[model samples]
Target: MSGKLYLKDKLVDEELDLSMMQLTEIPVKEIEQLGSKVLKLNLSHNLLTCVPANLPLLTQLTSIDLSKNQIVELPENFGQLTKLKSLDLYSNQISKLPVSFAQLKSLKFLDLKENPLVPELAKAAGPCITANDCAKGFF
Candidate 1:
């Protein structure tokens, strides 16, 4: 059940759709090299507690799905991926978003439905908000 998908010396550019696999944690160390060029990754419906630190290496990534997990906070470098366009974070246990979220200038689609963030906080983290805002949003 631990099959790996690779491409060239690096991992495949295909989507790593591992959603709803009843996983509690992923071995990021094993996949660090694989994510270097990965474009899309699906890690939703797991029991992840934190965002993978090595994810930033995937500079070519465009989309990521992390919904229905146990993540409480995003990494400070989460916005380093300037190529990222879409992010799904619905139905998680997240209570607050990292200030770095505003660094995602290329971000277009963001899903934050059914979180514990308040309305006021959401507005503060509007599309135009800055990293200094540190407020949540209804994306």
Candidate 2:
């Protein structure tokens, strides 16, 4: 929580890498202050148990990495990230996705490896490893 204002260049254009920050929740205000300067967010390797409720507020996000965390659920309206093209949710505790997930029409790359997906999801997301294969289940 003290690192709310922490800034890391992420070595990528318009990206903010807050990975391994040991944060339980995202600093929505601080990230918002950067405005559209942040197009990608990396919150991997943290203690997060759930996605930030207001994360959909960052509508400019093109990619998000929430891997290696304790995420159990996504915001019901996560599809609000219509610009999001890549999503990495590997090694998490997620079991089912929200109905709104089908609305992510721009998503091209997805990684849901190491998750305990439900039977339907597992069938739809067959062999999710490569970018192309990972994106098969979104809709």
Candidate 3:
């Protein structure tokens, strides 16, 4: 759809796959409150502009897919996802990352392909072109 949908208070514990749904936008706030115990989320192929503020509240979230969106910046609190292990942000509009991102010690796999690279942040992340670079300690 061209518009956004707000489906709150829905208990979706099993894998909820919405791949290739042609969804343009999603209201993150309403979705966060619904899946309090959700461990994985897939929002690929949407027309998002920014990372959702309430994302970190999904304490159980270990994997998230935000590929092919228009996200330009990530929230500083994005690092607060201590339980997060895998994050997919491929093909977005992110130009720079918050320094706080390094705090995600639990992060094991991150994808940042097709996004602009901030040299300074890349330097801070230690010569890593992708999260794989950081994960491999290439810096």
Residue 98 in model 3: lDDT: 74
How high is each candidate's TM-score? 0.73, 0.89, 0.73
Candidate 2 lDDT by residue in tens digits, 29-112: 888888898998999999999987789889999999999998988989998999999899999988888888888899888887
Candidate 2 Cα outliers beyond 4 Å, as residue runs: 1-4, 8-12, 135-139
Q: In candidate 3, which residue pairs get closer than 3 Å at backbone N, Cα or C atoms, i.e. clash? A: none
Model 1 agreement with the true structure over 100-139: per-residue lDDT tens digits: 7777877766776667766765554454333232233433
Give the lDDT of residue 59 in candidate 3. 68
Ranking by lDDT: 2, 3, 1
Q: Candidate 1's error at 120, in angstroms?
A: 3.2
lDDT of each: 0.68, 0.84, 0.69
**Candidate 3 residue lDDT tens string, 28-138:** 565665655567778888777887667676667788888888889888788778788888888888878776777777788777777776776545445346665657963
lDDT of 1 at 131: 28
Worst 10-residue lDDT window for candidate 2 reads 3-12
Better of 2 and 3 by TM-score: 2
User: To one decimal, what is the Cα RMSD in angstroms of model 2 from the true structure?
Assistant: 2.2
